[model samples]
Target: MKPLHRLLALALAVSMPGGVALAADLRVMTSGGFTAAYQRLGPQFAAASDNTLSTVLGPSMGKAPQAIPNRLQRGEPADVVIMVGYALDELIRQGKVAADSRVELADSRIGLVVRAGEPKPDISTTAALKKTLLAARSVAYSDSASGVYVERQLFEKLGIQAQLAPRGTMIERIPVASVVAKGDYQVGLQQVAELLPVPGVTFAGKLPEDVQSVTRFAAGIPTGAQHPAEARQLLDYLASPQVQGTVQATGLDSVPR
Candidate 1:
């Protein structure tokens, strides 16, 4: 080989891996409920892998269970999606997400919140929770999954559905704890994981054993993802023990079994 050609070949070989590494970015579309935990993990993942992550956070609007699907259907770019378990399954059934890429990350249970410095109320039983709800002058909750469940089923069962319907407030996007903290409501209800991050609010406790609602969260690579391997690595990092303490601090329990 000519001397110039030999030097060019050596340079190309040296640069190829760097080019491949620079070609990808992990695009993640995740629900707002998981935002706190992801905020901690996303940076660590990026630093360790030399890959960039772009995260879009919000509840699935309109007809989609996750924002990623709605974006994907419209030709948006997404490498991975993190959302409630059942929602991710729906995406898999539609062939938008890789079935084998699905991973259960954590389970978030619903809980009650009060303003910081206020006395926490007893919610250790279904009957006690019902009494507490009815007695509260005002109550706030999300417009998301836990809130919907409370509105559609739990409140009715407690026999205060009518009263709550007239006065209960449903918050969207913003954490319910913020509402309670501002004195807009006497109590707030949302995922335990969500409640922990808001300033000026205190976690009361999870719902009683018999009536608790736990939402399981999972992640999956989109079927046509440009960075499938990186997406898997991010998911693995989320489920690893190194991230477990951060997950717990955010009030989410690692998925059991």
Candidate 2:
């Protein structure tokens, strides 16, 4: 997305009213990865539409009570869900979300984090990354999309599953970087956006492209939404080109044009 196009997106969003005559209250459930950027842009959308957003934070998929799917299953009301694309697809498949409302917001790639002032390890290449993993005393990854990929796929690809198994920890309900920050882990692996915002951590860099897991962050209107009109408008504001800069600034890649 380019600046001119983003401006046009903003212009169209401002001109269009999706049918709500006045401000609306929307209940939104969001997961990690996109949370930082959403917090930054949520206010902008509210200012543009005078709509109020009530937000709940959770993972896209997990057994935890705060997980979006679990929250919905427990009868929580939600007008919108911002989470992993595949997780949203599952909701649509189950008829919990409107199929036509899916929209890709951004892509987040896994990155490495070390406690602030710690030696940043070399994970700039596949071989280097494998070596770094082998050398680490403790490794932490989230229990979300990126971590799942690393746990079930990435280590298998590197042929170090058994060796790294004991060393790697699947951190749940909190940022993986938090453990690294506390010196509980030597290395943290998670989405760049999730890692960058945590203090006392130094981001080494993204995993080498071939070994990376790119999780697509997306948004959709859930079934039985109280404010469907406002939810769609809010989605438009989020995916608009106007916010691409902020998206990148938060360590996310804009969805493909």
Candidate 3:
């Protein structure tokens, strides 16, 4: 979306009265990484556009029932899907989503977390992160994009994938930080934004640049959307400059201009 277009959308949003122009409720499916922002911004959009939001939270990928793509495949009612850009692209190719409706929302990077009060592990460098992973009794990563990178590339890049396999686990459909907080794992890895909302955990910081992965989140209306027009309004509002602050405050970097 261009800056001028975003401003136009913002202007339109500001001009409308909530529940006047849009009276139908919209069903939204969003990945965990972007859920927090949606939760906070959904109400605002509803008030401004008069559209109600019924949001379903899930991952962008994985076999889990809650994964966005899986729900869509099973005939769930989703007016809009906010998820990984590449995953949205795949849905477009599969004829499940409207390619022309895709809108990039934000980007997120991987971060580490530990149970609250635990000695925060040092991950200031590639060597330090490798050492920390080796020492943890149980290490967990999300089953989504960040997890895939940690499982497939980060460990291998550190040359300790074989050594860490015995203790490392891929956390499925659950927040890695929450599990770590409960002591299921000593260290948890996930998108930084996704980890911040989990209670009883301390953010350790992002992965070193040498081993970091950034996931771009985008929104698109489903081909079968019940409220495609309303969905587009919500997407535009989300990408408007007014909402970028909330997006960043929730741990994501707004889409690059």
> Scored by CA lDDT, what does every candidate get?
0.80, 0.90, 0.88
lDDT of 1: 0.80
Query: Distance from true position, residue 63, model 2, in Å?
Result: 0.9
Q: Write the per-residue lDDT of candidate 2 for residues 162-229, one digit (tens) a residue.
A: 99999999989899999999999999999999999999999999999998888999999988898887
Stretches of candidate 3 exceeding 4 Å from the true structure: 1-20
Where is model 2 more than 4 Å wrong at Cα? 1-21
Please rank every candidate by TM-score, starting with the best.
2, 3, 1
What C-alpha lDDT, on a 0 to 100 scale, does residue 138 get in candidate 3?
88
Model 1, residue 52: what's the lDDT?
85
Each candidate structure's TM-score, on Cα atoms with residue i matched to residue i, is: 0.84, 0.93, 0.92
Clashes of each: 0, 0, 2
Error of 3 at 14 (Å): 9.1
Task: Report the C-alpha lDDT of model 1 over 1-257, residue by residue, as the tens digit.
Answer: 54433443343334445534343488899886677899988876676556789988766433433455567788777898888888789889999999999999998889999999888888988888998898899989887778877878778877889989877887876789998999889999988888888899878899986777888888898898998876776787788766788888888888875
lDDT of 1 at 121: 89
User: Least lDDT summed over 10 consecutive residues: which range in candidate 1?
Assistant: 4-13
Candidate 2 Cα deviation (angstroms), residue 212: 0.8
| N/CA/C clash count, model 2 | 0
- In model 2, pairs of residues that clash are none
